[model samples]
Every structure is written in structure tokens, then in C-alpha cells.
Target chain A: MQSELHNGINVDIQEYADLIEESPSFQDEQYAALVTSAQNLVSAARSARVTSYGSEEGNGHMGLCFYFPTQTDLDSTIGDAYADLGLSQASPIWANYVNSSTRTTNND
Target chain B: MNLVLATTILLFLTITILFGCSEDRVTRTGIEPEADNQTWGVLIYAAGNYEGDQLSGPSMSSSRAVATVRVMETELNSPQTMTQACLATPAAQGEVGIYDVEFSPRQPVGLLNSELVANLGSVSTGDPQTLRMFLETSLSQMHADHYVLCLAGDGHGWQGMMGDYNNELGMLIDKLREEIESVSYLLPGGKFDILALYARNMGTIENVYELRNTADLVLTSTFNVEQPHHKIIAEWYRDLQSQPELNRDELAAYMIDAERLAQDTSEAVFFTTLWNTNTMNDVAAAFDTHSAQTGLRPAQLRLRLC
Candidate 1:
């Protein structure tokens, strides 16, 4: 997503917050309340913009990853909730340590 | 006299085989030696109506469901834990019937009667109502001092666990919570002992937090659940029998130990989290305070262990 300028300056965390607050989709209850809650947290932290990862345009400012002051801060803030949604599953299912050919079936 | 007796016995046996007993009748009337001491109730919901690349094993939910039920049968019949566990698992798109497993018979699921399922008409395996009916029926008719509800099959964390070929929404965690509560209300005594998520990559922090108030203990892995998921469970029951009453942490530790020894799936090698649901409020409180400080929209902070 293009970072729209505020007063002709780079958008800061506060501006990001305003954008998130305005979007009705963020609070959509159709999804799990937990998903909504997690997204809301990420939206609030986007303002920090201390670190940005992911693509900016097509995916709409999607890949930015922020750096936190401390690991504990991250865990207490959004990391814990993020992990719950299976976001870490974004990692490759097979880490090469385990051969896929022999992957055990949860089924028979 | 001998010929007459032999012919009469043969005719009697044939009649009994043809119409003597029904599976449902056996389930309602049959008695296990341990019924009075039966503390654990195992209920499995397997939603395998379709297949995709992101799945494991036979890819047939029904077969795997029985495979798991069979593995538990072996454990329950073992000399060490003959009377410790009782089970009822529903696999595939089937009617809502809880098969209370009995080991002496070596049946796939002891209320096993394919005829019963066919006659009743099957429900989509992913329907929460399926679970509700199973629990409601089992608790009312089966004897158990406690219970363990196992939801096996593909799990997309809080997105939902069991998927139905018929229903797009499938069985969400909220629906599961409602069913479990309903069972507890119908059969009140002990807290619902545990809710086991035997699906893949389910050990998420948020999912567990959402279930903190749902059960006393939650057993699930954060990564993809490797094959032979039922082996660890059987052994856990065996061990728990000897160690009868463990607090949440102790039970979690035991499960971790069982997984290490029996399950070889590398995906299941490390990502297991035991939620003593009762203690989750404190954990959630920590997150809530930080989220409060971070405001409504927080950043995905990258932090490393020192």
C-alpha cells in the first residue's frame, strides 16, 4: 500500500492508526473474533513503522515487518496472538530435516 | 436324541445371527468391567470427504478415523491399562452416533455396526451439531467418570478445525465450545477433562487462549501433526492409568514424553504446547496489557532469543 503523506511528510505511526481505524473491514465480525483482535493489534503497531517488510504496492504495503524494542515486548504485544492464528505456518511445512516421502498420515 | 439336539442348536444360532441384537442395543445394554471406574470419554470427529495437496496419509478421513480408533483399542486392551479408557469416534461423513469402544471384541469402534450408520443416514462430519448429538447421546447412555473429546483431521488454527464437504463454514472452535459445554451440562461432575486437537499446526497461542475457558487442559501441537497420531494417545492413556490423576502441567509433560518415544513424524518433533487453560488468564492478561500499551493496531515485532 502506498504510504500517503500527511502534511507532505512521510506517514508516521499515528497516520497508520487513522487509516486502520477508518477501515470497516478491520472490525468485521464475520471472521473469528480472535482474528479481528489480532488484526487490530497489527494495525495499531503499523504506525511504529520502525521496520517494514513485504511488498509495498500490489499487495498493498503487505510485507513490512516491524522491529520491536525487546523480544518480550513483541510477545506481550502481538507475537502471542499472531502465533495462535497459525501465521507461523507461513514457514515451509517440511524443513528438510524430515523427508516428505515418508510423512506420516494423520489418517490410516 | 443327539441329532435332534444338534439340529435345534444350529437353527437357534442361525436365528440369533440374523436378528438377535442390534449395535445400538448392544451399546445401550452391554457392560464393560470398568464401567464404574471409567473416567475418560474419547470422541473423535474426522472430516475427510475430499482431498487436497495439503494433507497426509490415506487422504481418506473415514479410514484414518478408524485407524486411530483401532490404535486406541490396542492400548486399552494392553495388560497395563485394561480398564482405563473408553472411546467413541465418528469418522468421515457419517450419522451422529458415538461408538463406545470395547476391547475384548477387537472391534474397530465398539458400537460398530455399519448397518446402524447406513440406516440412520450420515451427517457431515464437520458439523458441530454432529459433535453435540454424539456427546449428548453418549453421556446420557454411556458410563464415564470423565471425558476427553478429540477432534482429528485438518485444522486451520482458529480459522476452524473440522471441514465439511457439505458446509463451507465447517465446525469452528466456537461451535465446538458450545457442544462441549452442552455435554458438561448434561453430565455434571468433573470439569470436561481435556480437548485434544489432533489436527496439524494447531498449537497457536491465540487458539489456545480462545479455548482457555473451554477445558481444563488442552493438548495440541503448533506444527503439522505427523502420522500415527493415535499411537501417542493410546500410550498416554496407559500411562495416565498408572499415574491416574495428574494436574495439567504434569499431564502435558507426560504427553510430551510419549510423543518423543512413539511418534517419528519430524513435523511433530518439537511444536507441542500444553495449555493449562485455567492458568491462561494470566498469560492473556500479559498480552492484554501490552496490547493496551501498543494500542489497537500493533506492529509485528521481530525479536530474537539471546
Candidate 2:
């Protein structure tokens, strides 16, 4: 499970980096590092059974929460990022971060 | 020859008078002057906690009542304590106060006990239906310049949960709007001036937008819970009351800043407005201007997710 989670994170990071590079305006190293760090934190949390809960029958538990600085920050950053990348205003998957430790029940 | 001379002179005089009147007439172009007396009415409703005992419900109600009392005591011209302020007085005629009431579990339709019954000048409270009736009657009887409704409890856009069942915030706002609309019929010249709104997070934005077709402006926080910033809110209220010259847009901008500061704890703060498209840009420009004037760097915050 840990290796699988690590692989998933690696793939996501590569995709994010590719998207960032495609938009030359957001190629700054600071932005790249922030994304990478956040991804790693999420990946580590996902892999550890200490965070995730697995039921005896089969399925794994899932819960997610993102701790942004504030609602305004979230709005501005997401809006600006989407505008810079010429992306649509619909909700992006990047905003979702799983809180594995909080997961208690699993329904397969 | 005498009749022709008289008719010609009369025609010339009429033409001259018409031209002079046109030139002297007021065009009515500039902005209207602000009113002398500005009354801000804030109403907060917190109900539907049935599982708890009657005492618990009233306790929560009293907490909100205390908050309102504090805001009034500090911001209003009068300096009365909460208990004394609840009582009716000459100052109470123009003062800000809260009417808090709770209902017993068995008698959910009626009010258990009303605190401001004796001093029922302009403010009153009871069960939801009773409160609605009072507001409708009072608005019809009196003239209010500004109206603010702060619904303090759990609410979704169309659904609300105070205790067990779900209620509709939109419906409540609609009811209030209907009451106010009826009251407008009795005003002088059958018209009244409507100002902005300051409300809690529970469905305020949606509610404001729905009711604000008749109002001038609406201000609300984005969160769904109440984090009371009495000091800051009172200060902002005082600032607005003092500056009768500020326009609606300017007042809205100031409120955005106040909400941001109230919601944010860090040195840096951020805020957005659904009504004002250029609000963020204005805030950024203001920060830049202040920074240039003071030669100090504003606080920095990196956006991780938004």
C-alpha cells in the first residue's frame, strides 16, 4: 500500500510539473516546491495504516480535508492559478486532499 | 397701431420669461445628501434546540442577546448595561437592543418567556412566527432607514438545522422581505430608503441577494458559522455611523476589510466580495498606497490552496 501510494504521488507530481511547465508564467521554483511538499504530505498520510482504516470485509476508509490559510486565500489562489493556466472555472481535483487518519468505516 | 404694438411687446416678454426660467431651473444632477439620522436595525434569531432542556435553549439565546447588548452599549450613543438596557427608557426610543426568547420543548409553537416585553419600543422577540408578525407590524407603524437581519444558527442555502429538523433560510428571508414590502406601502409618499445588510455566514450571501433586489447593498461573510468579533464589528459600525458622507460602495468596501480582519488571525488578511467585482483590486491598491506612504512592507502570505 505504501509503495502504491508513493507511485500515485509521483505520477501526480509529474503531471503537475508538466502542467506548470506548459504555462511559462508559473515556472517559478517556489511554486513548484510548494506543490511538491503538499503532495508529499498527502502521499505520506495516505500510505500509513496509522492514517487509513481498513475494514475486515474488504474496502478501505477514505476522508479528506484541506487546511487552507483562509477562504479568501483559497479563492484568490485558485482563481489566479486557473486564469494563468487558461483552465476552466469548474472545481479542480487538486483542491481535494485526503485525511486518512480520520477514516473510520469502510463500505465496499 | 396701438393694438399691434401691445401684442408684439407681450409676445417678447413671454419669450424672455421662458428662457430665464429654463436657465434658472435646478438640473438635479449631483448625488443626494445623506440623511441626518441613520438607524441601523440588527435582528438575530437562534432557535430549534429541542434535545436540550428549556434552560439550554434560553442560555444560547441569551448568549446572542449578550453579544447584541455589548455591541449596542459600546457603539450606540447610550451607555446602559445589559440588564438596564433591556428595560424601556427615553434613550431606548432611538437605541439598539436585542429581544431574546426561547420556547419550551412541549410548546414549540409559543414563546416560553420574553425579556423585552416591558420595553417593547421598537425591538421585540418571540417564536419565529411571532417575531415575524411583530416585525411586520412595527415596520408598518414606523419608518426605518436601514435594516440588518443576522440569523445566528446552522443553515444551508435552502436548508437549515437548529436542532433536529431542517428549515429554509431562503424562506425566512423571503418572509422578511414580504413584510418589509408591505410596510413600504405606509411610508411618507409611499416610499422608503433601503440601505445595506450586515449578516452572519449562515446563508447570508444568498439571502441578501434574494432580498436585495429592493435594497441598495449587502455585506456578509463566507463562512457558515459565527465567530464573533464584537470589538472590530463595533468599531466598524461606529466608523460608518460617524461618516454619513460615505457612499454605499465605500461602505461595502470598508465592511469587506472588517470581515477579513475578523476572520483572519495572522498579520496578513484577505477578503472577497460577490457583489463588488473590483473589491479585491481596490483592497490591493489601498494596501499599495498605504505601503508607499508609510515606507513599510505589508505582510506576506503564500497561497498553497485556494
Candidate 3:
């Protein structure tokens, strides 16, 4: 999911945003603590997918996706992260995409 | 009488120095000298010097150059029309000699200095100037009407030709533009025809931006070049060598066909090609990949998982 064309990590920014909300006090400058926790979960998901071939219930939801409460939620969460990081506001910002494969997709 | 002799001596010295300078003269324009006949030039700059401990680990670039030159010699009928420049290792610790490769059955594949040879030096491949010199020598001396500059070495996609070697692809393209500009002057229109990158990770979109103006056509790969990659390309060239007249696009297409066929045979980590040219502008081409994972949304990326 990492690319030179785009900026930042490939995982969903909203997941990190949700985790950051959980922490009462503000963490490090760039929300390092929140990102670290989110990244570890992503790593676990990726590791699990390595052996997750036969475990599929065949529901056809193995492909990952990101859903928002609203499109505004998507824009607010992803756009704010982009502004904070000073990354290119171009097409290939994959962090905004729901390009995950390691975990099952749901309306979480 | 003494003044006349001294003047004559000075004139002689000046002539000799100028002539010597001309012999070593490098054209920085990066332009191709125009020729009436169709001539093909392939320059393979193989930087095998691996900095530290990796030097001892299975280095085959020198042999790979030998193999490619051998193929060219064997398959190609018109030796005079085709020219190849190979820069490779086994000379010194951090340097490589750029050899003028001709199809000589009597001689070895890469003989250092022969009647057919041009220049000799253990030039550092890590230096950007050295890379420019190699290209300059090819365009100025070979005098090919049409050129196919092949980068046959280690490469990192966006970072460029050689990250460890110090030149980035972007800067290399910047340097090459001057040469391309020089070549463009001779022709009715555009610059030197094709740039074939036989190294690793050179077919990405990141590379396309750097290479847009440097070459008319680029033959590059998304994956790290495998052991069998060069041999497959050689085989393709051997087959195409029979065809007397094939334009730039046809030639590149043939190479891509061979690449796709070769990708089928090997279990590579990743394999994709970007057949980029002036004609195929801004279009993203997808690859036919094989994978074991049974993700229902196969297109989204099952190949990455497996």
C-alpha cells in the first residue's frame, strides 16, 4: 500500500483518528502514540492474512474498505491529517483510500 | 636562427596538444550526430561496485555483459551498423572501464584495448560525471542515426539509476536532456529514440516524469530484474535481429512481448512493464499477475497478499 506517488501510511486515517479520540490527554506532537497503536493493529491484520486463506467463510468481504459516518467525516479526518503532515494533496494519497486487505470490511 | 627554431617547436607542441585534446574531447550536448543510414547504439553501464561487504556476493554483471555482447555478435549480421558500449567491473576496487563493443568473432566479448576499441580508463561508476562521459562517448564516436541506450545495472525506481552509486534517475535525465538536445539538432524532429532500462524498479510512474523528455520510448520494469531477465531480452533481440526494418515502437513491442512471456516462467516477487512513449501518454497499464490467494475481489489486490 506504500507508494512514492502518494504520502503517509497506507492504512485508514479515520482508524487513527478514532484511536486518538480514545486517549484523554494529547500524546506526542504528531499523534505518534495513536499512529503506533493503529500501525500495530494493521501489522497484526497483515500477519493474520498470511495464514487467512482457507479461513474465509466465502462471504466475499475479504477485500478491505473504509466507510465513514458521512463523506464529510471522511474529508475532515483524512484532510486534517494531510494538512498536518504537509503532504501532497494529489490523487495517489492512498491513506484516504480503504486499500486494506488484511482485515474484513464492515460498517464500523 | 635560434628564434625561428623555437617558434617552430612551439607550433608543433600546440598542434600535438590540440590533437590529443580532441581525441579525449567529450561532447556534453548529449545530442546524436545525424547519419543518412539507420544505425543502432546500445550502451550498457553496469556498476558492479557494491560499496562494502556485498562486493563478494554473487556478482555476475561482468559476465552478464559478456553474455549480451556475445548474443549481439552472434545474432547480428551487420556489425558495422550496430554499436554497443559496456562499462563493467574486475578492473579496480571502485571503478569500471567503458569498452567499445563490436561483433568480433576473433576477439573476446569485452577486450580492453584493441584496434576496434575507443577509450580505456578505470572510471568510477559511482560518479555522475563518469556516467555522462560514457553517454557522450557513445553519441560522439558511434555516430548512430537512431540510438537505443540500455541501462544494464542496479537501479532504484524513483531514487533513480543507482542510489548506492550516487546518481538519481531525475538528475540523470536532466543530464541526458543536454545530450538529447544535441541529438535532436540533426534529425527532422525529436530526440534519440529509445531508452531501455534493464535494471530493477525502473518502470514506475515516478520514473516516467524523469524520462519523459530524455527518450522517445522507454523499456523498463516494475519488478527487480531476475537472473533470467537479460537472457530473455537477448533472445528477443536475437529474434528481432532478423527483421531488416522495424521502427522504434515495433522494436519496443517485441521486447515487451518477450518480457511478458518470460514473466510467466518465473515465480518472481513482482513483474510489470511500462511501455511508455510519446504515443502512449498519461495512460496507466495494468499487469497480468498470478497469485495463490483466493480473495473474492481479485482485482483489488490478491497478488500482493500472496
Off by over 4 Å in 3: A1-108, B1-36, B51-62, B91-95, B106-116, B143-145, B163-188, B225-229, B260-266, B279-306
* TM-score for chain B of all predictions: 0.69, 0.45, 0.64
Which lDDT tens digits does candidate 1 get at residues B1-306? 999999999999988876656453344323433345444445555444424212254522235555555555444432212221222234333444445454433453433422222122466556777666666665665455556667766676555666645653356555666667766665435456667777765654446656655667777765543445656666676676556555544555666566666554433333444456655544444334433333333333221100
Residue range B136-252, candidate 2, lDDT tens digits: 443432333444433333333322222212222323444445544554554433322332232333322224333443344333333433444343355555555456345545555
Q: Which candidate is the best by lDDT?
A: 1
What C-alpha lDDT values do all the predictions have? 0.46, 0.33, 0.44
Q: Could you tell which candidate, 2 or 3, scores higher by TM-score? A: 3
| TM-score for all models, in order of appearance | 0.56, 0.38, 0.52
Q: Residue B251 error for model 3, in Å?
A: 0.7
Candidate 1 chain A vs. true chain A: TM-score? 0.22
TM-score of 2: 0.38
Runs in model 1 with CA error above 4 Å? A1-108, B1-34, B48-62, B78-96, B104-120, B187-190, B225-227, B240-252, B265-269, B299-306
Judge candidate 3 at residue A26 and give its lDDT: 38
**Sliding window of 10 residues with minimal summed lDDT for model 1 chain B:** B78-87
For model 2, residues A6-61, the per-residue Cα lDDT tens digits are 43332133324454456556536555444444444444323321111112221111
